[model samples]
Target: MTFENTKEFAQQLDSQDKLNKYRDEFIFPKVNGEKVIYFTGNSLGLQPKRTKAYVDEVMDDWANLAVEGHFYAEKPWWDYHERFAKPLSKIVGALPSEVTVMNTLTVNLHLLMVSFYRPTKSRYKIICEEKAFPSDQYMFQSQVHFHGYKTEDAIVEIKRREGEHNIRLEDVLAKIAEVGDELALVLIGGVNYYTGQVFDMKTITAAGHDAGAIVGWDLAHAAGNIKLELHDWNADFAAWCSYKYMNSGPGNASGCFVHEKHHNNPDLPRFAGWWGHNKERRFKMEPTFDPVQGADGWQISNLPILSLAPYLASVEMFEEIGMDALIEKRDRITAYLEFILQEIDKEVDSTFEIITPADPSERGCQLSVLLHGEGRSLFDYLMENGVITDWREPNVIRLAPVPLYCSFEDMYDFGQILKAGILR
Candidate 1:
């Protein structure tokens, strides 16, 4: 499909877009009395207008029923989280029994590692991508330290080639093989936050298992943004934050996955609490912890219902639209965004390099642009001009044209604003 840097062309694409109506479903911030063109869904998603009702339901229940809301409210607070299992399972391609909603991303990762990251005398190293998100980096450091190992020795980072922006699949596989029996766990972000590269999870998971290591994923960027088959891929465990592509509010509850094969394993270690205990026996308040089977077994405390409310609202929205529809629009709109960037670069005679992989299968909605002659001022200029985007260190601006709410018109408008910012 040929893309033109014109309002008419963008409008034509928008007219044909089945998901275009969803743009109105979200509330966008205004700059100079106009709704800003949003490009930061990869960072924080715009709130759904329906979110208020979900929250209000909880608030109303608390107001009227008091403590009894836990049992008698419309969507009873005690069983509130159970609503997410079916829909979220569909989104991440897992069985309902294999999925649950719980703590935030990094916290869940740490909790999951207690079970998946067991180290031995000879096998204690963990393999992860070089320059992982700072939180994950810190988590790895702390986890290895807790288990009494030096950070440098216990963590094996698969690095990109000097001039390359993305890590090669072969390098990752080779690293797993090289680590061999010494590898205790293979934990990587399914979608790299920096370069927007989507790793080959199925192959990597298989490789990790073959190398005698447990495999897991941090799906913060990949969860709702891409197609995932955690069950079919046979990933031991995975966790993702809902506030990004999932469109839940800030710091919302996270979704988790644990394969059914591990459900019946009573010996698997985890930090447990009353919520994770068997629901039937929970009121009994027995001294011994009998964990609820499946992903719920990993919960450490009673859920924060308010946090789960907005997430349930967003997850239901994903169920309504389905991932196939989202990915179809994602691929086309992201390509359009890339085309617009290229067109703008040509128009401005500026050197703008997209570090994200060109293959549709290797990226999601995000396109990270490396500005050769630009700096922070351009990012500031974009922000002031009603283009809400994210700027990383050096000169890269991350743009995520989220299929749910962002439009082709937004992409074209962003190009015009970008050109103006560069010229100014």
Candidate 2:
């Protein structure tokens, strides 16, 4: 659909959006009694109104029963952690038993590393994108160093062929072949946080598997924003945080998925904890720890219900809308945002270049715009006018218009604001 920079045209598009009503579901941040057109759901999502009610139910249950809430409440605390299974399973496209909502992003990443990244003498290496999140690079480096292996030899970093911002699928497949024999595991972020580029999980998984290596994903920025079928893709394991597009509160619970294919594979190692032990004898205080089946077997502790309440609220919305439809709207919303941004750039001196892919299917909702000429000041100018996008290091400003909360008007309005901010 072609667009022009007119308020009437923008309103008409918003009017036709089948998911238009969902904008009212979130608590929009206000600036001088005017709703701020928030487009940062890629970094953090707006809170759902039901979040309070969900938390209240858990609080009231705890208030009334205190210690016994673990066993007696309607959503028993003893089984509180398990409540996340079915809903989280749907989000990442996995079986219920293959997922669990647990520790934060980095912690889960560390735990999965301990299990999957076992470096041997002949085949003792890991492969990851060159510009991975700093935390992940550190985690990968430490894993190799702890086992008396040099980080340089034990980790293969794939760069984007010099001038590129995103990796091509063919390049990734070729890398797997080139490094296949010596590679132990391929741990990649499902989406590049800086570039807002969504990686092709199915093809990458196939390449890694064919190369005789395990493939795991860090889905920190991809989970709720993208439609994923981790099980069908045959991903060995994956982890994601809930605070972003999932609308879970800040530092809220995180989740992980382990494919059913690895459920009982004796070769797959796990870091054991009491909660991962067999439920029948978990509280029996047995000396030996027998892990449960599936991804629940990866769980380490009883859930923090207070932390999980926000996710329950968000997942209920996802269940109602169905994620497939969400992605359809997401693609439209993101494509509109990108089209408008580029169109706006055309109006200017071509000062801004998009680092994320133009293909809607290859990206989530976010657009990473690289503003030339002292970029941080340009981002500051947008923030001064209440245009709330996130800026990564150097010069990239990320704008994500979440379909669940953003409008076409929001996209155009931001485009106008950005033009005024930059061209002036």
Candidate 3:
């Protein structure tokens, strides 16, 4: 699809977009009575207009039904989290039994690691990309330390070539081979938060398994942003937050995946909670723990109905629109955004450099720009003008044109606003 760097061309594209109507489904941030051009879905997505009604439904149940709501209300609170499995499984490409929504992202990561990341004296090294999200880094370090290992000795970090922003897949594969017998786990982000680079999860998972290491992914940025096949990839486990591309409310309940191969394994170690006990005897409250079958076995507590409400609101939209439609628009709009930026670069002799991969398959909706000369000042200029974008530490500015809410015209207007900022 050839793109022209003009508002008329942008409008033409918007006129034909099937997902254009979804923009109205969300409530956008406004300034001076006008909606801001939101390009920060990688950080936090806009609230869906229906989120309020969904939350209120839960509130209404509590108001009238009181304790009886647990068993008798509409959509019984006892199995509230269960409904999410099927819809979220579609979003992340896993079986309903393989997926469950429960704790927040990091907590779920720790829980999964308890069952998957079994380290020993000879094979305990964890391989990951350098400068993974702070939480991930901390989790890795703490987990290794808990097992009487030093982080420096047990962690193998994959770094890029000196001038490159993204880690090459070859380098990642080689790290698995190099670590070989000592590599106990390979845990990395599916879509890097800072670079917006979508890692090859399938290839990476295979390589890690070949090296006799358990594999997992933190799909915080990738879950709803890219096409994932966690089950097909045979990933041991994975976790993701619902706030960003999932459009669930901020710090909402997160989702997790566990392959079916691990389902009936009674020997697998986990931090058991009453909620994860076998449903037949869960109310019996026996002294011994008998775990549930699939990913539901990892759950520690009953569903947080209020926090889970927004996810229901969001996943319904995902099921309605479907991922294929979402990915199609994502590719087109992101390419147009890249084209607009390049045109702006030519027009102004721009000093900014795109740090994300040029290949569409290697990225999601985000484009991380490295401002060479004037960095934060330019970011501030756009912010003051009401162009919402993400600014990472040091120098990267990320602009994500989410397919659900961002229009092609928004990208055009951004280019114009960027040109004005550069000229000023």
Q: TM-score of every model?
A: 0.99, 0.97, 0.99
Per-residue C-alpha lDDT of model 2 across residues 102-175, encoded as one tens digit per residue: 88998998898777877788888898998998889998988889988998888898789778888888888888
lDDT of 3 by residue, 1-424 (tens): 7889888999999999999999999998886677999998888999999999989989999999998999888888988888888888998999999999998999999999999889988999999998899999999989999999998999999999998899999999999999999999999999999999999999999999999999999999998889999999999999999999988988988999999999999889999899998977898989998888999989989879999999999998999999999999999999999999999999989678899999999999899998878778899999888899988889889998999999999999999999999989
Instruction: Return the lDDT, model 1, position 320.
Output: 94
Among all candidates shown, the one with the greatest lDDT: 1
What's the lDDT of the predicted structure labeled candidate 1?
Answer: 0.94
When 1 and 3 are scored with lDDT, the better candidate is 1
RMSD of each: 0.7, 1.4, 0.8
189-305: candidate 1 lDDT, tens digit per residue: 999999899999999999999999999999999999999999999999999999999999888888899999999987788888899999888889899999988898888788899
All models: lDDT?
Answer: 0.94, 0.86, 0.93
Rank order by lDDT, top first? Answer: 1, 3, 2
Q: Per TM-score, what order, best first?
A: 1, 3, 2
